[model samples]
Structure formats: structure tokens, C-alpha cells
Target: MQEIKERFKELRKELKLNQSEFGKRLAVSKDVISNIEIGRVQPKTLLIDAICDTFKVNKDWLVNGSGNMFNDSKENVELEELLYKISKENSSLYPTVLKLSQLDSESLVLIDSLLDKILKK
Candidate 1:
């Protein structure tokens, strides 16, 4: 079986975020990340959202440590799931939507147009 902590350490290095920075984003201390990475603690399922959110990690990749780090998507299904999970984990996303809401009517309209374009893929 692939060890999650090892996978996490590998991916973290790939993202170029030091443990302190990554833990800060995940709302945990660097020691927490270090503990997990060093096999001092095993992460739980609830941490999944936080982990994925902070790292922009592929959940399937983290959970199973299998397949491409990137998953192939068809029908926008994967993207929709990714967005929903990310939005759920990050409360700031609501503020992001609100910030986008501040855009003028034409800009907001263009944003919607862009989303429609993506969804149509």
C-alpha cells in the first residue's frame, strides 16, 4: 500500500511550499504537517478537504496514491466535483464569489459566459 504521509511529502515538495507555508494554509502548525510526513501521526478522512483545499491536490491521488496526479475528465463531471469540494472546504470562496459579484454588469456577464463555455465542453 502507498503510504499517505510519504505521498504528501512528495507532493508538497512538488508544490514548492515549505511545511510552514503549507500548514499555515491548511490551518495547522508546521509540526502537524511534519508529524504526518515523518510518520508520527496518520491523517484522518476529515482532513481530506483541508488537505485538498490547501494543496490543490487531487483527492483521488491522495486517497489512493494511484493513477496520474492528474485525472482525465469528461463531461465536466470531475471539474464540478473539484469546484464543489474546494468551495466547501474554503469559506473564503464565498467572499471570492462576492468579490466577483462586485464586478460591473458587463464583466459579470462575461464571467457567466466563460462558465457557460466551460460547462459546454
Candidate 2:
């Protein structure tokens, strides 16, 4: 559990997010993040799931520290961070990204095909 807490803080630092920013993404308070990081409070399963889902964290690595920290490449993580910023400002691209993220593999393949045709690429 202590190791998991440390990994939680490490993941936040790797994402270049402060406690408050990280908490905001997880819908938690900064104090909750602080307490968990300091081993003062045990992190709940729901909070863990939120962290993993929001940041694409590997649950195995977050809980047992066995695999890579992130399920996606660092580039994907950076893109997600950018999307978060865009969402805060209510950018048109934010909704597009949100919708794109929810698409299934088949839909994504269709979208890719359409994009390649439209772009002549």
C-alpha cells in the first residue's frame, strides 16, 4: 500500500501535474491527493479507478508496480494533457476529441479511411 501511494505521486510528477491539477482530473481534492501521497490516508478503489481511467495508467503498475506506468505511449499522455487544457476552455476540438475517444475500433478505422481520402494522404 505504501509503495502504491508512492507510485501515485510518481505518476503525477511524471505527468507534470501538481496535486491540485491531478486531483481535479480525478474529481478529488488536493488534500486527498496530498494525504494519499504522504501515506496518511489509504486510497479508495474508486479513486484508483478514476486515476487509471483519466490518465491511462496501468492498474497493475499503479497497484503492484509490476508493469509500465502508462498503458499508452508518452506521446499519447501528452496529447491527453493537451486535451484536458483544451477542455477547460471549452474548445471545439475538445468535444471532437471526446467523441473520438469514445469511438470503437471499427468506427475509428472508418474515420481513418475517410480522413485519408479527404486529405489525399
Q: Which stretches of candidate 2 lie over 4 Å from their true place?
A: 95-121
lDDT of 2 by residue, 1-121 (tens): 4498899899999999999999988888999999999999989999999988888999999999888999999899999788878887877777688799999999999999999999994
lDDT, residue 47, model 1: 77
TM-score versus the correct structure, for each prediction: 0.55, 0.75
Supply the global lDDT for candidate 1. 0.74
How much lDDT does candidate 2 score?
Answer: 0.91
Superposed Cα deviation of residue 91, candidate 2 (Å): 2.5
Per-residue lDDT tens digits for candidate 1, residues 30-99, read 9999999998998877776777654456788887887755333432435545565678789778787668
RMSD of each: 8.6, 4.4
Model 1 earns a TM-score of 0.55
